[model samples]
Target: MTAALCLFLAAINIATLLAFWWDKDAARAARRRIPERNLLALALFGGTPAAFAARQMFRHKTRKQPFSTYLMVIAAAQAGGALGLALA
Candidate 1:
């Protein structure tokens, strides 16, 4: 990947991770939680690894229904794109 793409991915991943952390804290505080769609959107923006790591680390959304499905789809898409690029 190019330097710019790498940097963008890194930033998005970090942001996704922080968002998960923030949402966890919000839940614990009984505050308004971050929307599930927003988290999934972060994954769509190439934050799959960070989102997965955050889910595992925070013990959040591991068992959720559509959320897990969305993450899986995002991961699959990223892998497929990488494989396509490699074969090209």
Candidate 2:
């Protein structure tokens, strides 16, 4: 069950990344309109890594803003979670 969950999360992350990579401007526009709370919810549900990677790869949402800052924080948390899982 844990493995399945991890796989599902990873797939979602990958799909999110691909979506951003393919259309960063569209994604950014959607992201801008979407509520920060919802984005955070998505990250909390295991989408942070892809979100962060997309931000970096597309150079999107790097400006100094509360939303960007929150995304970074979530990215760090995701990294920690991944590290912990790996170590375990």
Candidate 3:
């Protein structure tokens, strides 16, 4: 990936991570939670790396059944694309 692409990905990841953190805080306070769709949208938009890191670090949403499954699928797809690029 080019430097610009790397930076873009990094920004996405950071945004997603912070969003996750905010959601966690919101959950604790019984506030309006960030919608799952929004989180998945961020992941699909190339934030999977940061999303996974945030999930692991915050221990948030790790136990959510279908959400975990969806995240796995996103991660798999991203990894596959990266591998294809490397092999090309």
Candidate 4:
């Protein structure tokens, strides 16, 4: 909840959102797309909320197997971690 942590999260989330937008654009243009692992890494590093937002906003990667599953898992883990911190 500190200012620095909020700033970092905001920056990462914005980057994640932009990455998704770029990937969707690339997909439409048949260009080289962003890697799934990189996208997941962004989510893992505090971009989960923005990842979900981008997925819904761009309608991209919604049905991808393993990727959707992984994103959900990451979100769940993040929620649990946050809950743990709150309880602690």
Scored by lDDT, the top model is 4
C-alpha lDDT (0 to 100) for residue 19 of candidate 1: 96
Between 2 and 3, whose TM-score is larger? 3
Q: How many pairs in model 4 have backbone atoms within 3 A of each other, for residues 3 or more apart or on separate chains, i.e. clashes?
A: 0
* Order of models, best TM-score first: 4, 1, 3, 2
As for candidate 2, its clashing pairs are none
Give lDDT tens digits, candidate 3, residues 1-88: 6899989988998999999999999999999999998999999999998888889999999999899999999889988998998999
RMSD values for the candidates in order, in angstroms, are 0.7, 4.0, 1.1, 0.4
The superposed Cα distance between candidate 2 and the true structure at residue 69, in angstroms, equals: 1.6
lDDT measured at residue 9 in model 1 versus the true structure, 0 to 100: 95
Off by over 4 Å in 4: none
* Superposed Cα deviation of residue 67, candidate 1 (Å): 0.4
How high is the CA lDDT of each candidate model?
0.95, 0.72, 0.93, 0.99
> Clash pairs of candidate 1?
none
User: On a 0 to 100 scale, what is the lDDT of residue 67 in model 1?
Assistant: 90
> Candidate 4 on 22-85: residue-level lDDT in tens?
9999999999999999999999999999999999999999999999999999999999999999
Models 1 onward score TM values of: 0.96, 0.59, 0.92, 0.98
lDDT of 2 by residue, 1-88 (tens): 4899989898888866765565556665665444457555667677777877877888866673997888778878878887998899
| Model 3 lDDT, residue 86, Cα | 92
